[model samples]
Target: MKLEAIPRLSLGYLPTPIEKMERLSAELGITLSVKRDDFTGFGGGGNKVRKLEYLMADAVAQGVKVLITTGGHQSNHARMTAAAARKYGMKPILVLRGNRPDLYQGNLLLDHLFGAEIDFLDPDAYFTEINPRMAHHAAEAEARDEKAYIIPLGGASALGAMGYVNAVKELSEQYAAAGTPAPRYLVAPVGSGGTLAGLHIGCSLYWPETEVVGIAVTGSAVPFSERIAVMANAGAELLDLEKRWTADDIRIENDYIGPGYSIPSDAGNAAIKLAGNREGMLLDPVYTGKAFAGIIGCVEKGSIEKGSSVLFIHCGGSPALFPYAGLLTSDLAG
Candidate 1:
């Protein structure tokens, strides 16, 4: 069960650059760098592309003709999934939360441009309705004699998490090349927990001693840290790795969410502006912005000690910025 033995498509640019954020590091009194997964370079470049490489390989193996997945209206995952499906010559069907808006912008616009079939459900219907809707799409595909593959929410399944486990391995090599020690902490945004799950396992096996912290962008009744532990173990099983994770092993910061999911938080917007103005990097409101805000919050609270080396995973969602133009412009002006 070697990771290399697993089937994966070459969908994203590998080993996205790791750049030191000197200004932010000095400002925060900690050494800070970013793993630029935002530059993954496929389907508009995001962390989802890594997960899709494995998922798409599975779909192709199963002779899938239609790919189905669920996400919010501005879901970066949905946008990337659409692109991956098209690249593999499979049809993509997205079941998104919320009613259709009069204007299609941001990732929604890209989803449409990718020529995906989309269905919008009421916001309250998301949890209860998404699975059934995806199943319905599958049944319809069956009626047409075309196979549909349903990807889980955020592509959080064990198979897809392999992408980040491999990423940790890549990071290890990069650290060695740059002659830097393993980072004191690795931070990332957690929406569905798949990426964090993979990183936990990856850090355990490839870069020991580096703690991983996930910043939750969306609140969930089901404790995502516990859920992500189970997922990491499942991925470990897939890779035949000896490391086993538990809820205690996973650390998630949930305070920075500000409001509900998809709605930009004041702190998140400020963090977005800070990153853009300081590092010339764009961070979306949904994920990376809140995650960076968490980093700032943690530093202010002394949770992350001064002079510690921290690396943030810039999981791409900058296109999501387009949809929040009004809010962001107001922040910029004020």
Candidate 2:
């Protein structure tokens, strides 16, 4: 499936390195490494960089003068896509979900800094609801004779998923070059499901030996499983891959989502603190923290084999820390 066949501008720092987390591994009694997708060379570094590259490339190719996207108030995708849009000289319109923050912070701050137009929502509108607003805003921009483009939330489309598919190709080469063993399990926080689906498809096609495990940072496995399958199938088709994976091929664990999306969890806070103090790794409360807690819990419950090499994909969100300062305070241990 020649991943580069699709249009993508150079945005993210390609092939974000995989670093071994020796300190955290010793503390947890497992061989642990982190795929630093957070440093993927996007806006402040994140998994979103890869997706935005393809999305904006399409926008530019179509002569888009305005780039419109939707997400939560603190969406990494929106922030990065806005940056990409600016780089291409196109204005960005962010249809933000929910109430605007009392204080602009994190991704929201960056969005404003990038001069992306802010369209606030009902503090509870789903992406399905947020999307049409984006289209309406696009129409409004078009009425002014400006070309508009809509890049959906999380950039979960088939083309964007190809970024991770390309990532696996990069990983496979890195493993071969470094003479490292393939991980027994690949773990990541699943939100929009595109990243995990890409991992599932990429690993199945290339690194067949590794098992892909997605810890739901939000949402339930029942729905995410379907989304993952659809994405993987679509991504596979995008790549012209012959083999398609079924539901049996995907493994998702939603046991660690605490109080829903973007909400804080005690376990998540603890996990973030543990990683920070023990491994000198910073993880945000929403995504990576909860996902890490899930990994720790799974290991404790024997859901993950004791001696297997477990690789955790730090999908990034460290900037969300501003709003949840209290939870992170006094939580770290030496």
Candidate 3:
């Protein structure tokens, strides 16, 4: 796909390790392993760092002095964006979609530690309020003779999706080094769809045999698969690849998204505990926890065949765990 032609900064630990989970594999009746993007090792380390590598490079090239983004209160993207902006010597402004908490915790605490200018809006205003508010901040920066770059929700732009496309390339090399066939299925959480879209394009190019399964963590009025297909095609266009994706090409498990976004569900919390206790892997409630639960759901429902090889992308959100400590401890306590 000529991914090397793109401008990207070295912002993460390249080629994160893939580790087999022997204990969890047996329990699930499948050969299971995880790509540890959690250890990306920058801005508190997460999947977003992969996208920011390309995004920050563009921002620097454009002489952007202020960076603005929006997300929920405990968004890992917001925390990492603030960190990336600080690392690159730019001001970060977070216009989050919620009221300010009485006490900062989890990713919110880290965002403050990074010295980001933070604003809180009503949760109901998410779709309507985020862009206009960010534009206002951009105008203010312009008045001060500073250039501002507005990164979209979760860095889901076509250019940023290149990060995960590059990641799948890394995955192909890893499997080749081990002299093993690629897994039958690749699984990951789907938030803004950039990561999934990238994986779709990447797998199409490198690991065509493997299917990518997206676990949606949020309920959206617009179908996420359609959105993801559009994103994947856009990314494919950037890579100059002839392949295009349709909504039917995307396989999404939507049942695991319980209650609402950011609300912990019984199944999700149990999955978090199972991973931590069995595999010593820590996953948060918002993203990884729900996605992990989806893996179990798929296996139980026979959607993923027994004894098949499955690889999960651990996209990282353990920082958000702190904010949910009270509920988790109460629910998971023996």
Per-residue C-alpha lDDT of model 3 across residues 165-217, encoded as one tens digit per residue: 99999999999999989999999998888999999999999999999999999
TM-score of each: 0.98, 0.95, 0.98
Better-scoring candidate (lDDT), 1 or 2:
1
lDDT of 2 by residue, 215-262 (tens): 987874358888888889998888788768777767888788989888
Candidate 1: regions farther than 4 A off: 331-334
Rank order by lDDT, top first? Answer: 3, 1, 2
Taking the tens digit of each residue's C-alpha lDDT, what string does model 1 give over 1-334? 9889999999999989999999999899999999999999999999998999999999999999999999999899999999998988999999999999999999999999999999999999789888889999999999999999999989999999999988999999999998999999999999999999989988988888998999999998789989999999999899888888878888999999888899999999999999999999999999999999999999999998899999999999999999899998984584
> Model 1: number of clashes?
0
Q: Each candidate's lDDT (Cα)?
A: 0.94, 0.83, 0.94
For each of the candidates, the C-alpha root-mean-square deviation to the true structure, in angstroms, is 1.0, 2.2, 1.1
List candidate 2 stretches off by more than 4 Å: 220-222, 330-334
Clashing pairs in 1: none
